[model samples]
Target: MNGVVQNDAWREEYNTLKEQYTELKRLKEEVKKLEKSCFTSSQKQLKKLSTIKKQLSKGTSGQEVTAKEVTEVEESLKKIRETLPQPNNLFLRSIVGSINVTIPNSEDKLVYKERYENFKRNVTIVICILSLLAIWIRGYTRLPEFILQFVSAWFYLALTVREQILIRNGSKISTWWVLHHYFSIAIAGIFLIWPEGECYRNFQMQFLYFTLTISGIMYLQFIYQKGQLYKLRTLGRAHQMDFVQDAGMRSRSMGDLYFLVPFLLYTYVFQLANSYRLYNMYYMQECQTLWQVPILGVLFFIVALGNTWTLALVLVRKYNS
Candidate 1:
């Protein structure tokens, strides 16, 4: 008798999920027609998107969902996701990412989201660890700054390729984030051409420390994000790729922002310190008899300001929401 009752309850929930899916599919069509007015009707479209998100996030009510329903939900959502404005660094994706020497675009094939994210995390760990090691043990190798430049460029290229893959695979990291890697690559190139001198000796060791700090932070973030993604995968809402991992909770970008506050705050402080040192160098040049402004340092200062502002926005949105 208990088994029969449980079966009946599952059947009822299954029926409801099917109805919700159908309604979401219908809204998807409406969204397509209104795509031209999407900017104008931003609020309405946001609400509609939220509704679709909720439908997808619905979990098993202690009942086994059929494979057929699962496929339908996945297909329906992916189709809509394809319609989202593709945010990416066009030049990097179009030109740089396809350079024959980089990793092949295996990501073009439909891969499991969690598996793909894990791959990205692995790549991050491998590249960052290698770069940090090269910096720390530069004595034995007697490596030149150009060696670090080459390594930095190589890693940033990998980053560019990875961001392209993520964008194609429905990750929500913005085009700005993708472009950041490009700037990093460009900076590494600048570092390659920068002549070694007394000024560089003053800057080199500090920069190496900065590199280690950033790399360490990235590794920690990877561990946290990977665990979070695993939880989302277990919960069956891993399909909501955009909001998972970053947020400890589902459908809460604000929660992700809050969760990252500590990390982002550290980032802000480091960037601020870096920018201050750069500004001091630049000011000294102004007061000196020679053209001594640190061009790369000034550029880093500018980037630091932008990053700090971006973090502030994330925090403000988190609290307001």
Candidate 2:
């Protein structure tokens, strides 16, 4: 009778364990059902996902409509973007639409600041790297010079062309940008006709040194500009999506002038050194290479003045404000 009682107790324990296991499995199934109903567990993300889905279903293109899928998607995205509250930015349209869709342009800045930023970043990197490589490599023909000229021409064309994508997209940078790069093209052009001599060889290394400075400054500028853009983006003060400054933007720009002062001084000092060297090499030393000596001197002076004037103007603007 005692053995029988022990067997019955063991069976009851087994039954309790089985029931508990089944209950756990049932709870898991219920959870899966809830997840299936919601599609996403996070409630915060649901609104955005639902908005997109609704837009696709009932947007510019009718839901059952099979044609113009690209246009439909572009239109839906534009409409959704329009729903967001944005500042009064009428510089350029930042919203780049699909190739097929006619962009619904407002007097807004470029299609997207992010895209323009990426574009400029990529271009700056490629041109600088290739230009540096071209200058470093020794060649019999004007191939290296040609490469440098090609880079200059490409940038100049991109910057100077009327209705270029960047300008149209409302890139409101300084006027000195136009002047500096334009002069760069002219300088590179002079290199094409330059003859090989001791002066030529010496000038090449120095010019490379100067190019290194230019590249370094540009890299630093790119980083600083991106940082500024990030701050504006966080504050939502950016023009459309581009870096359009307002009165509020000056808070950081003014505070940072101290940092820029050093960069400006370095630039002027380097250009002055270059000017002195050119003057000594050409006039004092009696070098007859017009392309490398006198003309270069004149161009270097112009660059220094142009660059200095620009920085001075920026400083005055910041201080006066």
The candidate that wins on TM-score is 1
Residues 1-321 of candidate 1: C-alpha lDDT, one tens digit per residue: 455454788899999999999999999889656753643455455565555555656753344545466567666655554544433456654765543222213354334445556665665566566667767776665364456567777777766675565556566665555656766777677766655555555566666766667766766766766567666667776655453335343324665545556875676577667657756665554323223235566556666677677667656665677
* Candidate 2, 188-287: lDDT as tens digits: 6676567766777766767766766766776666677667766776787664534422222343567765655676678777877777788888854436
Q: For candidate 2, what's the RMSD?
A: 16.9
Work out the TM-score per prediction: 0.58, 0.55
For each candidate, the alpha-carbon lDDT, in order, equals 0.59, 0.59
- lDDT of model 2, residue 91: 20
TM-score (C-alpha) between model 2 and the true structure:
0.55
Supply the global lDDT for candidate 2.
0.59
